[model samples]
Target: MRVIVDHPGWTPASEPRRTVRTENSAWTATAGATLILNRVGEGRDQAPAVDTYSPMDLGGSIPENLRSALEEQGPVQRLRTADLWEALATAIIRQVIRADQARLMYHRFCDAHGAPLPEAGPSAFPRPETVLALDEDDFAGLGMAFKRRPLIAAAGAFIESGTKWAELPADVLVEEVQAVPRIGPWTAGATLADVTGDFSLYPYGDMAVRKWAAHASPDIDWPTDEGTFARWWRSFAATPEQLSALTVLTLALGGPRGQDQPPS
Candidate 1:
């Protein structure tokens, strides 16, 4: 829930903004709603406003045919993180690794570097410069693999690129992420989906996603190729991001393996 703002004239004070900081708080957003604040800080009234994100518009973009199914699966919403750098870092950790293991390392990374805010739940993931400051030994202590080459390399490349994720289109974001060495389509696609909040691009390299698609919708001929999957995803649902969430349902419901638990 840590919120980071990167605009020239704005900031979120390096912490997550919560409508309800605690369960006992009086303030509460309506059920199944994401509240977005356009501006923050003591004098945000004078600062240039950040672009507003509306979930209402996001929901409307979904194809009618998939509405029922999406709803049946559960309420789905996009959460805008302070920065995509954490997403990119976690994606790198997940490359060719098991989810549980990757998750452990991800948490460890956050714990090692995150700066705890006064009331925010957990510390926000450290900034890119904080990560870049660490050496191999420091990263290795956090249970990272490959001497943390992929993470450090990717962080360096992303930092050098100087691209503002808020401004990049899906395609350009894909290209930008993929340009980094050792970061392929799967890594790039996952990063783009997270950073840009665009799930149209399928993670072709994700075995779980492919397995889910094969079992969830056997009627449709799913292709292993990334390009083909992108076409099917776009045509099937205007908001392919929903498909990403649906796949989680499929996985939870037992995908091609036909069991609640995914294959080890």
Candidate 2:
């Protein structure tokens, strides 16, 4: 299915791709969109294609819970693009190694493989097989953990099965991804952000985000529960239109090129 992401200002004039997780958190995340979203089953080539997206289906509708206050904070700013599988590799490497180390490893890995890095906000995440086939000892030489070898391999295998990482149902992908070696909720969440364009996840593993939460409330600490974070996200929107608006805002505020804070 072609997925055309619906956001206020962001438009996917470019192809969809995986988004990179950077030390620059302020960057807006771009969602991968396709024609499937606009399909009415009659055929997309037809004039004025199928339209209308429901909140329940998108997981981005307005919030009506006690978290109504969440909307007052701001919208989720995001870019109009994503880098697909490439983002997954970077996210995994980040989890396995320090940011600096991960970046170095990624560059080196890309260089050796001839996938020179892109200057854009994001690029396609490498398939798991490509990374898994690498020499683990090489990363070890960079002081990265050796334990990640299995995780990387697992990711490669997962992608090999025509697994649509970005488009899979969240529950299924989350469960499956967390099962991979060294992968957990955070890693899976990042993968989803790049692949599916589902923005409900706040990418909870960032230390910088944790610190932001700590500062938000003394009672709240890093690694806060999903329930709490969800509630916080709820406030980012008040209506379906508002939710879309926040998606744009959240990405913009997060530092589209500078530093990105966790969705407020």
Predicted model with the maximum TM-score: 1
Clashes (candidate 2): 51
Give per-residue CA lDDT, model 1, range 1-264, as digits (tens): 112121111112233232211111212111123335432212212221222222232335444434444344443333433356666775676666666566456556666886654543444556678877888788868777473777777778768774675467778878777777788877777666555544445463245655655654566567877457656554543455445544333333331121121121
Clashes of each: 2, 51
lDDT of 2 by residue, 27-106 (tens): 22334443322222232232222222232232444333312322333333233223334544555655634444454565
- The per-model lDDT (C-alpha) reads 0.49, 0.43
Clashes of 1: 2
Name the top lDDT candidate: 1
> Which regions of candidate 2 are displaced past 4 Å?
1-84, 96-101, 116-127, 164-167, 204-230, 235-254, 257-264
Q: How displaced is residue 2 in candidate 1, in Å? A: 21
lDDT, residue 31, model 1: 16
Whole-model alpha-carbon lDDT for candidate 2: 0.43
